[model samples]
Target: MQYQLRVSGNLYKELQQHLFPGDGKEAVAVALCGRYERDGISILLVHELMLIPHKECYRAEDVVCWKTETILPFLEKASKKDMAILKIHSHPGGFPAFSDVDDESDKDLFSSVFGWCESDSVHGSAVMLPEGRIFGRVITPKLESFPFDKVSVAGDEIKVWEHNTSSYSPDDFAVRTAQAFGEGTYSKLRRLKVGVVGCSGTGSPTIEQLKRLGIGELVLIDPDEVEHKNLNRILNTTREDANLRRLKTEVLSSHIRETGLGTKVVAYPFNLYDSPEALQELITCDIIFGCVDSVDGRHLISQLTNFYLIPYFDQGVKLDADGKGGIDKVSGTVHFIQPGSSSLLSRGQYTRQILFDECLRRQDPVEYSKRLKAGYVHNADVDRPAVISINMQISSMAINEFLNRLHSFKNEPARNYAQVSMDYSDGSICNVAEDDLPVDDYQVMWAGRGDLSTFLRMIELSAVKV
Candidate 1:
């Protein structure tokens, strides 16, 4: 089910300045075991694993840990016994070398892995990165890493290989899972084609996380190039990129490649708003992520999500300049749009007035820019989006929404749309949600029929049918 997208076009250097943030690289296996039947749970992708290397003891900042109790929520709804075949997380900090703590952990963790792989013979191996430059391998039993030549991730796909078959170790599973990066977050990701509509701000983080999460194929779109003005945010882009005017999509595609993560990224240096192929290509993806600044973009994407039943996650952020200059307020929203769930447009989250106006102005970037500099009654302008904190907050919220949509969590959580505003005008060490704000057209979707939650419903319905 793994997929790949051949990259095309040259990326302008301006766009390269937006990937990776603050002191961090990756150091763990982003592995996935798929299409297996034993778990009875149709398909599952376990992420953010903490591997016990029998020689290391450590904690993780980026490990995607599943609340062991999270499994309980699924039991009442699904039929499969719990199964864990995949183990992946990065050496977020410290050397990629397994700590003594890792040793204590890997046995039981892999014990789970060993059991999960019962249907298969070879256990999965450990993927470790000693440094940003070298990707090391640690096979179970033998515990030695062969060197991989080059790691590439186009979008969601992850491929790890040494010289050839010689690097394929029978003792570990990373060899095979690494082959496809089988939807690193869900068993279905391998078969799913994803689209990233923008490559700056939230879009950059979205793609960065998607690469780490390991999806098989991705199509990237964005006509904008990196600008020094964007240095305040945008993941993975470097400052130097601004000087060179690199295309956002191309630069992001290269950064994804650097991870040695195997994903196929198809780059299109065009705005989805004007690109006919954009909608056509997105229609084919399992899910679509929207990160463009135009309300028109989100409205258009929402319409598409409603028609095709493709799951979509959209993020919006706003920040008010500080009275004296230090950003005073931040706000963000993360909304999940299920194709058949609800009419995002009908809800009035996006108005025909705004959509039409933006559409009309789409042909003229400069005129539209002037109007945005003038601001609107309820519109977010790309020129002055909510500062980084708000952007980061909603980015995390959106990523979590992706996770929630992927896994079958308990409670059949309702309300897939939420927006929060932050104002530290008073300056207190606390977090609060901004309510009663105008959400006149905030569309709500994902009425539980797009992903694992959808599957969870099926399981429950089937149980009732019995």
Candidate 2:
């Protein structure tokens, strides 16, 4: 099984501060983690962090020891919640690999942790360098350790570190892209597994760009089939696809395979709300691009990404045409959501009332229609105008947002552009920072609660186990 660890950028910053503290000695900390294990993939999502006080440990440049009792409370909590434990420490001297001393310390510490927790789950030990880059390993129940295959930090900028950096020789189609972003960034793209929700309009173009840019793997989720109306906006779709009523995911997956770029694709022809298996597949993605139009779909993806500590990019387009045939408004928005920080809900992308109404409309359409007629719910069924040019523009912006987060080529920091708004009618654009957005207490309460008994804490999902 491939083992991985994910930490929110906010928590990673906290760990860095406590671990470094401008000292020339090592320091220790403990992290309580929620886990997701399926299909030979195991991930640890850090839920909470506890820093051992410097005064409580004997510190040196290469070695630091703390009392085992300091972590008993956290261990008890982990046992109660079925969570895993991760022991993290700092290397003040910029050591790249785990030392022999670290191996000995981890063996002893995890042995006690496995015994105390009394569960058949894996634990981890990590080391952070002065530059805030982290690497770690997972320890099996037998106390045998294997290096983490991947370690990712979900923040304003998506940062990922892999145990092995596989060599890449770009094909003819990707040679130009490699030159534009540098070979290192291109190599990173080849290692990333991205998920795209929704396959029409924005999602099609988003998937096209990702595959051409050499994404290693893609998980495509959408329940709809190709209708004639989608031919105008969806890329690579033909009249035959529309007539055949082909699944959007299937069409996209086939196109990617035909490109011969070696980008693996897994298509799920099912709605995100009703499929627990799709949710499990989505969590395996390093980054998510949410191109769905429904408020409920966006809301669900926001919750799932936060739970798994994955960075998310959500984009939508709005076209308002005056009944007289004149264009009144044309606009689009792309929101970049970081785990443990401001979310789409907190950013006012949708209100709780709207989310509730949408969910009702999906679960009980007859009741929703009756409520709509009674003026108890908003009428959200109006068909909006869509143009390929507008969709492509917004899709490019969203993909560029993802690229900037990976390579950081923008003049301003990624954190400053939590939301990007493009007004095509006005010919203007705007960016909003994360600090400017409001926070929702409810979203905060659920952040990093991975693999809960109920998926996303939604009762309906509990019935369908992954």
Candidate 3:
């Protein structure tokens, strides 16, 4: 099985500060992680970090040794919760590979950790360089060490360090793309597994752009089937598909495969709310695009991203027209969400009442309709006008936002443009900085609580088994 370690941007900054305190000697820290294992992929999501003080360890430029008792408390805690442990240390000299000394130390440490935890689960150790690039190995129950497939830091800028580098030569189709965004950026795209949670409107165009840009893998999630009304917006859909009631994910997956691009696609013909299997696959993605219009769907995705330490790009389009053929408003928004930061809720995208109503409508539509008729719930079932041009525009903007996060070609830092708003009616565009957004206290409390018994820590999901 392949192994990966995921760390939130904020936590990585903390680790960096303690690991490299301007000292020539090595420093060490320990992380208690939540585990996710499925489909031959195992991931460790760091939940807590414990940095050993310099005074507690014997330090040298090449090696550092600390008392095993220093981590006893963490070991006990992890054992109680059946969590995994990862020990990380700094390599101040920029050593590219783990030394023999590190191997022996890991062996001794993980051996004790396994025995104390009294489980066959895996534990790991890693080394971080001065430049913030990390590489690590996983230690098995048998005390055998295997290099980790990759170590990813999910922050304002997504960073991934792979143990083995696969050589990729851009084909003629991608030559223009490589020239526009350096070959390095193109290569990064080929290694990313991106998830698009909707399959129509914005989601269709977003998936098309990602595939053309040579995204390595695409995970498509949507429960709806092709319908006559959506034919105008969903890309590559035909009348025959609507007649056959083909699933949106199936249609998109087929279209991507027909392009002859090397990108792999996995389609889930189910919604994220009720399908534990869909959630299992979604959590494996490196990045997620929220193309759904429902407030509850967006809220759930935001929560999932924070828990799994994945970067999220959420897009929405709004068009209001008077019955008398006058246009009232035309606007759209694209929000760049980093793990452990302000979310769509804190940005006023939706309030608690709206989320509750959406949930009620989804779970008990008959009751919701009755409540609406009784004047207890707002009427949210109106069908809004959807234009292909508007959907494409917003989709392109969201795709560009993802590219900016990867290559950072923008004039200002990405943190300055947390949200981009466009108003076609007023012919105006605006950007909001992360500092301007209110802090999401709820997101902060739930971040990195990965792979819980109940999905996303919701009571409704406890009954669904993957």
Candidate 4:
């Protein structure tokens, strides 16, 4: 089994500050993390750090030795919450591997943490190099250790470090993709698992692009059935499919399988919020594409990205008319939200009232009806203008942004932009830049909050039992 650890940029920075105090001596830090299991792999998500006051520890530039008594309190807290504990320390000497000293100390240390705390939760030890890179392993209750194959950090950008020391060569399909981006990038793309929320206008096109680009696995979620009107925008849909009212996810999934490609596809033919199994399955994806238009769905996706520490790409196209058959507003936007960064709410794409109204409708339809009738809140438009050309343009831009993030072909410096919007009417494009770093305590409620009680307050139906 492969073990991977993901930490938010905010939590990651805190770890650095706590463990790498500028005294050029090693410092010790303790953190509590959530554990998730998928496909025989166990993932640890480091949420927050509980720094130990180490004013009287035996310290050196390469090592720090603390009494086992100092960590018992922290271990007891983790034991009560059933959360895993990580013992993190810094090596300012830029040593990548665990030293002989580490090997001797960890076995005795973690064995004590598990036995003394009386918690079955898995615990591990980590070492941070001078460059802020991390490597760690998971120690079982029986004192067996498994080295992590990868460590990923998600923030304004996505960074990954693989620990496997093996030779890799691209195959023919990947070699062709390497022509544009190097072979290393193509290899990464083949290992990624991408999720698409909506399988309509923007979603269908994005799914087609991802499969053709050779993503390793895809999780497609959509509940709607193909209608005659949907034939205009949805790809891989025939008149027969619309006539038969076939599920949108099934049709697109079938099309991908017919190609005889090696891409793995899992389709969920139900609303994600109503399908707890599908929502939980999203934890396996590396990145997600939000093609949904519902305010409730977008809000869920936003929270899911942060909870799972995955990157999110959200795209939307809109066309408004002046009621005289003339276009008044022709615009679209593509937003890339990194975990623990600015969200759609913080970026002003959505308002608190919208989210509140959506929640009310989902939780209490009777109250929502009364409020709507009293003119307190308005419903979103049911039928909006959609064109295939505009949808394709927006989807293409989103795909290119994903590629740029992976390969960084753009020459400009990287900044965290809340959104990139294009107004076709005025032939203008603008980028709304968000600050470089998140506020110290921003979204603390959701950061590394692996699994919540009701799946971000959607209700009992949204809870993930699996």
Query: Best by TM-score, which number?
Result: 2
**Segments of candidate 4 deviating more than 4 angstroms:** 16-28, 50-61, 67-73, 91-95, 130-132, 163-168, 362-367, 436-442, 452-454
Model 3 agreement with the true structure over 386-445: per-residue lDDT tens digits: 999999999999998889888889999888878999999999989999889987987777
Distance from true location, Cα of 380 in model 3, Å: 2.2
State each model's CA lDDT, in order. Answer: 0.48, 0.91, 0.90, 0.80
The deviation in Å at residue 266 for candidate 2 is 0.7
Clash pairs for candidate 4 = none
**Candidate 2 Cα errors over 4 Å, as ranges:** none
Of 2 and 4, the candidate ranking higher by TM-score: 2
TM-scores, all candidates, are 0.49, 0.98, 0.96, 0.89
- Give the top-scoring candidate (lDDT): 2
lDDT of 2 by residue, 1-466 (tens): 9999999888888899999988789999999998988889999999898999999999999999999898899899889988999999999999999999999999899889988887898999999999988999999999888999999999887889999988688878889988888888899999999999999989999999999999999999999999998899989999999999999999989999998899999989999987878898899999999999899999989999998999999999999989887779999999998888888887878898999999999999999999999999998788888999999999999999999988888999998999999998889999999889986666566667788778778886886463
Worst 10 residues of 1 by lDDT: 6-15
How many clashes show up per model?
63, 0, 0, 0
**Models ranked on TM-score:** 2, 3, 4, 1
